[model samples]
Target: MIVIYGIKQQLTPIKAELSDVIHQCMQEVLGFPEDKRAHRFIPMEKEDFYYPGGRSEAYTVIEINMMAGRKVETQKKLIYTLFERIEEKIGILPIDIEITIKEQQSYQWGFRGMTGDEVNDLKYKVNV
Candidate 1:
Protein backbone atom coordinates (compact mmCIF):
# COMPACT_ATOMS: atom_id res chain seq x y z
CA MET A 1 0.00 0.00 0.00
CA ILE A 2 1.06 3.57 -0.64
CA VAL A 3 0.15 6.82 1.08
CA ILE A 4 1.05 10.04 -0.61
CA TYR A 5 0.98 13.39 1.12
CA GLY A 6 1.48 16.61 -0.77
CA ILE A 7 1.62 20.25 0.19
CA LYS A 8 1.16 22.99 -2.32
CA GLN A 9 -0.48 26.31 -2.89
CA GLN A 10 -4.10 26.80 -3.97
CA LEU A 11 -3.07 29.14 -6.77
CA THR A 12 -1.38 26.30 -8.58
CA PRO A 13 -3.45 25.08 -11.44
CA ILE A 14 -2.54 21.45 -10.86
CA LYS A 15 -4.51 21.15 -7.65
CA ALA A 16 -7.55 19.75 -9.39
CA GLU A 17 -5.67 16.94 -11.08
CA LEU A 18 -3.16 16.10 -8.37
CA SER A 19 -5.06 13.27 -6.72
CA ASP A 20 -6.01 11.61 -9.97
CA VAL A 21 -2.51 11.89 -11.28
CA ILE A 22 -1.12 10.40 -8.09
CA HIS A 23 -3.55 7.51 -8.22
CA GLN A 24 -2.64 6.77 -11.79
CA CYS A 25 1.04 6.87 -11.04
CA MET A 26 0.68 4.49 -8.13
CA GLN A 27 -1.41 2.06 -10.13
CA GLU A 28 1.03 2.06 -12.98
CA VAL A 29 4.02 1.57 -10.72
CA LEU A 30 2.56 -0.99 -8.34
CA GLY A 31 0.36 -2.86 -10.81
CA PHE A 32 -2.54 -2.86 -8.36
CA PRO A 33 -6.10 -1.64 -8.33
CA GLU A 34 -7.25 1.29 -6.20
CA ASP A 35 -9.23 -0.93 -3.84
CA LYS A 36 -6.10 -2.81 -2.76
CA ARG A 37 -4.18 0.29 -1.87
CA ALA A 38 -4.41 3.16 0.58
CA HIS A 39 -3.61 6.68 -0.55
CA ARG A 40 -3.67 10.05 1.13
CA PHE A 41 -3.38 13.54 -0.33
CA ILE A 42 -2.88 16.66 1.71
CA PRO A 43 -3.01 20.14 0.21
CA MET A 44 -1.95 23.39 1.80
CA GLU A 45 -2.30 26.97 0.73
CA LYS A 46 0.78 29.09 0.20
CA GLU A 47 0.31 31.30 3.23
CA ASP A 48 -0.18 28.37 5.57
CA PHE A 49 3.45 27.35 5.37
CA TYR A 50 6.79 28.81 4.46
CA TYR A 51 9.41 27.29 2.22
CA PRO A 52 12.80 28.13 3.52
CA GLY A 53 15.92 28.96 1.50
CA GLY A 54 13.93 30.79 -1.15
CA ARG A 55 12.37 27.69 -2.58
CA SER A 56 8.84 29.03 -2.67
CA GLU A 57 8.50 28.78 -6.42
CA ALA A 58 8.08 25.04 -6.25
CA TYR A 59 4.53 24.18 -7.11
CA THR A 60 4.46 20.71 -5.57
CA VAL A 61 6.28 18.62 -3.02
CA ILE A 62 5.44 14.92 -2.79
CA GLU A 63 6.21 12.57 0.09
CA ILE A 64 5.36 8.92 -0.36
CA ASN A 65 5.30 6.31 2.38
CA MET A 66 4.84 2.75 1.25
CA MET A 67 4.63 -0.76 2.64
CA ALA A 68 4.86 -3.70 0.28
CA GLY A 69 5.87 -7.32 0.21
CA ARG A 70 8.53 -6.73 -2.39
CA LYS A 71 12.28 -6.60 -2.57
CA VAL A 72 14.40 -3.47 -2.44
CA GLU A 73 14.96 -3.43 -6.17
CA THR A 74 11.25 -3.62 -6.79
CA GLN A 75 10.64 -0.79 -4.34
CA LYS A 76 13.23 1.39 -6.02
CA LYS A 77 11.77 0.71 -9.42
CA LEU A 78 8.32 1.64 -8.16
CA ILE A 79 9.58 4.91 -6.79
CA TYR A 80 11.39 5.75 -10.02
CA THR A 81 8.29 4.98 -12.01
CA LEU A 82 6.20 7.25 -9.81
CA PHE A 83 8.67 10.11 -10.18
CA GLU A 84 8.75 9.75 -13.92
CA ARG A 85 4.99 9.85 -14.16
CA ILE A 86 4.70 12.82 -11.83
CA GLU A 87 7.22 14.76 -13.88
CA GLU A 88 5.44 13.93 -17.10
CA LYS A 89 1.99 14.84 -15.82
CA ILE A 90 2.85 17.96 -13.84
CA GLY A 91 5.44 19.36 -16.22
CA ILE A 92 7.78 19.67 -13.29
CA LEU A 93 11.38 18.60 -13.33
CA PRO A 94 12.55 15.88 -10.92
CA ILE A 95 13.79 18.08 -8.12
CA ASP A 96 11.59 18.26 -5.04
CA ILE A 97 10.04 14.82 -4.71
CA GLU A 98 10.80 12.38 -1.86
CA ILE A 99 9.96 8.69 -1.35
CA THR A 100 10.44 6.34 1.55
CA ILE A 101 9.98 2.59 1.77
CA LYS A 102 9.24 0.64 4.92
CA GLU A 103 9.02 -3.12 5.01
CA GLN A 104 6.58 -4.35 7.60
CA GLN A 105 6.00 -7.72 9.19
CA SER A 106 2.75 -9.42 8.37
CA TYR A 107 1.41 -8.55 11.81
CA GLN A 108 2.24 -4.86 11.66
CA TRP A 109 -0.35 -3.44 9.26
CA GLY A 110 -4.12 -3.34 9.59
CA PHE A 111 -6.42 -3.08 6.59
CA ARG A 112 -10.20 -3.16 6.46
CA GLY A 113 -10.17 -3.75 10.23
CA MET A 114 -7.97 -6.79 9.77
CA THR A 115 -4.51 -6.86 11.25
CA GLY A 116 -1.22 -7.65 9.49
CA ASP A 117 -1.32 -11.40 9.17
CA GLU A 118 -4.88 -11.53 7.95
CA VAL A 119 -4.43 -8.80 5.37
CA ASN A 120 -1.19 -10.34 4.22
CA ASP A 121 -2.78 -13.71 3.74
CA LEU A 122 -5.68 -12.16 1.88
CA LYS A 123 -3.52 -10.17 -0.49
CA TYR A 124 -1.12 -13.05 -0.98
CA LYS A 125 -3.86 -15.41 -2.00
CA VAL A 126 -5.32 -12.80 -4.32
CA ASN A 127 -2.18 -11.35 -5.89
CA VAL A 128 0.77 -13.65 -5.27
Candidate 2:
Protein backbone atom coordinates (compact mmCIF):
# COMPACT_ATOMS: atom_id res chain seq x y z
CA MET A 1 0.00 0.00 0.00
CA ILE A 2 1.12 3.56 -0.70
CA VAL A 3 0.05 6.57 1.33
CA ILE A 4 0.55 10.07 -0.10
CA TYR A 5 0.30 13.24 1.98
CA GLY A 6 0.33 16.82 0.79
CA ILE A 7 -1.45 20.13 1.07
CA LYS A 8 -5.05 19.92 -0.15
CA GLN A 9 -4.93 22.50 -2.90
CA GLN A 10 -1.67 21.35 -4.41
CA LEU A 11 -2.37 17.66 -4.02
CA THR A 12 -6.02 16.96 -4.80
CA PRO A 13 -5.95 18.03 -8.42
CA ILE A 14 -2.98 15.80 -9.21
CA LYS A 15 -3.89 12.66 -7.31
CA ALA A 16 -4.86 10.64 -10.33
CA GLU A 17 -1.77 11.62 -12.30
CA LEU A 18 0.48 11.07 -9.33
CA SER A 19 -0.99 7.66 -8.64
CA ASP A 20 -0.48 6.61 -12.22
CA VAL A 21 3.12 7.79 -12.27
CA ILE A 22 3.81 6.07 -8.99
CA HIS A 23 2.32 2.81 -10.18
CA GLN A 24 4.27 3.06 -13.39
CA CYS A 25 7.50 3.53 -11.44
CA MET A 26 6.62 0.56 -9.27
CA GLN A 27 6.01 -1.60 -12.30
CA GLU A 28 9.19 -0.46 -14.00
CA VAL A 29 11.48 -0.83 -10.99
CA LEU A 30 9.92 -3.56 -8.87
CA GLY A 31 8.11 -5.58 -11.47
CA PHE A 32 4.79 -4.95 -9.79
CA PRO A 33 1.68 -5.99 -11.70
CA GLU A 34 -0.77 -3.40 -12.97
CA ASP A 35 -3.52 -4.82 -10.80
CA LYS A 36 -1.47 -4.31 -7.64
CA ARG A 37 -1.86 -0.56 -7.49
CA ALA A 38 -2.93 0.58 -4.03
CA HIS A 39 -2.62 4.27 -3.33
CA ARG A 40 -4.20 6.35 -0.58
CA PHE A 41 -4.08 10.14 -0.63
CA ILE A 42 -4.29 12.45 2.39
CA PRO A 43 -4.95 16.04 1.47
CA MET A 44 -4.50 18.24 4.50
CA GLU A 45 -5.14 21.90 5.14
CA LYS A 46 -2.20 24.28 5.00
CA GLU A 47 -2.15 24.77 8.74
CA ASP A 48 -2.44 21.07 9.42
CA PHE A 49 0.34 20.06 7.12
CA TYR A 50 3.72 21.35 8.26
CA TYR A 51 6.77 20.81 6.11
CA PRO A 52 10.48 21.52 6.23
CA GLY A 53 12.12 24.66 4.92
CA GLY A 54 12.83 25.10 1.20
CA ARG A 55 9.82 23.03 0.18
CA SER A 56 6.77 24.59 -1.37
CA GLU A 57 3.13 23.78 -0.72
CA ALA A 58 3.55 21.01 -3.25
CA TYR A 59 5.74 19.01 -0.93
CA THR A 60 4.48 15.43 -0.83
CA VAL A 61 5.33 12.54 1.41
CA ILE A 62 4.85 9.06 0.04
CA GLU A 63 5.02 6.10 2.35
CA ILE A 64 5.19 2.64 0.88
CA ASN A 65 4.37 -0.41 2.99
CA MET A 66 5.19 -3.89 1.80
CA MET A 67 6.52 -7.30 2.67
CA ALA A 68 10.27 -7.36 3.32
CA GLY A 69 12.22 -9.19 0.65
CA ARG A 70 13.46 -6.85 -2.03
CA LYS A 71 17.17 -6.16 -2.31
CA VAL A 72 18.50 -2.74 -1.34
CA GLU A 73 19.48 -1.95 -4.91
CA THR A 74 16.00 -2.77 -6.12
CA GLN A 75 14.46 -0.51 -3.47
CA LYS A 76 16.80 2.35 -4.33
CA LYS A 77 15.97 1.93 -7.99
CA LEU A 78 12.29 2.22 -7.17
CA ILE A 79 12.88 5.44 -5.26
CA TYR A 80 14.97 6.98 -8.00
CA THR A 81 12.49 5.89 -10.64
CA LEU A 82 9.64 7.44 -8.68
CA PHE A 83 11.51 10.70 -8.25
CA GLU A 84 12.30 10.93 -11.95
CA ARG A 85 8.93 9.81 -13.22
CA ILE A 86 6.92 11.93 -10.82
CA GLU A 87 8.91 15.03 -11.72
CA GLU A 88 8.63 14.36 -15.43
CA LYS A 89 5.01 13.22 -15.55
CA ILE A 90 3.39 14.93 -12.58
CA GLY A 91 5.50 18.08 -12.39
CA ILE A 92 6.57 17.39 -8.80
CA LEU A 93 10.25 18.03 -8.29
CA PRO A 94 12.42 15.58 -6.38
CA ILE A 95 13.21 18.19 -3.73
CA ASP A 96 9.53 18.54 -2.95
CA ILE A 97 8.90 14.79 -2.69
CA GLU A 98 9.75 12.61 0.27
CA ILE A 99 9.48 8.84 -0.08
CA THR A 100 9.98 6.09 2.43
CA ILE A 101 9.56 2.36 2.19
CA LYS A 102 8.49 0.44 5.26
CA GLU A 103 8.88 -3.27 4.95
CA GLN A 104 7.80 -6.04 7.29
CA GLN A 105 7.93 -9.78 7.36
CA SER A 106 5.44 -11.50 5.11
CA TYR A 107 3.84 -13.11 8.15
CA GLN A 108 3.08 -9.68 9.56
CA TRP A 109 0.81 -8.76 6.69
CA GLY A 110 -2.78 -9.99 6.72
CA PHE A 111 -4.90 -10.02 3.58
CA ARG A 112 -7.58 -12.10 1.91
CA GLY A 113 -8.36 -13.64 5.30
CA MET A 114 -4.83 -14.99 5.53
CA THR A 115 -1.34 -13.82 6.39
CA GLY A 116 0.87 -12.70 3.53
CA ASP A 117 3.23 -15.65 3.89
CA GLU A 118 0.38 -18.10 3.73
CA VAL A 119 -1.11 -16.57 0.59
CA ASN A 120 0.75 -18.46 -2.08
CA ASP A 121 -1.24 -17.20 -5.01
CA LEU A 122 0.26 -13.73 -5.29
CA LYS A 123 0.69 -12.66 -8.89
CA TYR A 124 3.87 -10.72 -8.22
CA LYS A 125 7.21 -11.56 -6.64
CA VAL A 126 8.32 -9.71 -3.50
CA ASN A 127 11.97 -10.73 -3.44
CA VAL A 128 12.95 -8.75 -6.48
TM-score leader: 2
Q: For model 1, which pairs clash?
A: none
Q: Candidate 2: lDDT over CA atoms?
A: 0.94
- Poorest 10 consecutive residues by lDDT, candidate 1: 119-128
Clashes of each: 0, 0
- Taking the tens digit of each residue's C-alpha lDDT, what string does model 2 give over 1-128? 99999999999999999999999888888888899998999999999999999998899999999999999999999999999999999888999999999999999999999999899888889999
Could you tell me the lDDT of residue 33 within candidate 1?
A: 71
lDDT winner: 2
lDDT of 1: 0.58
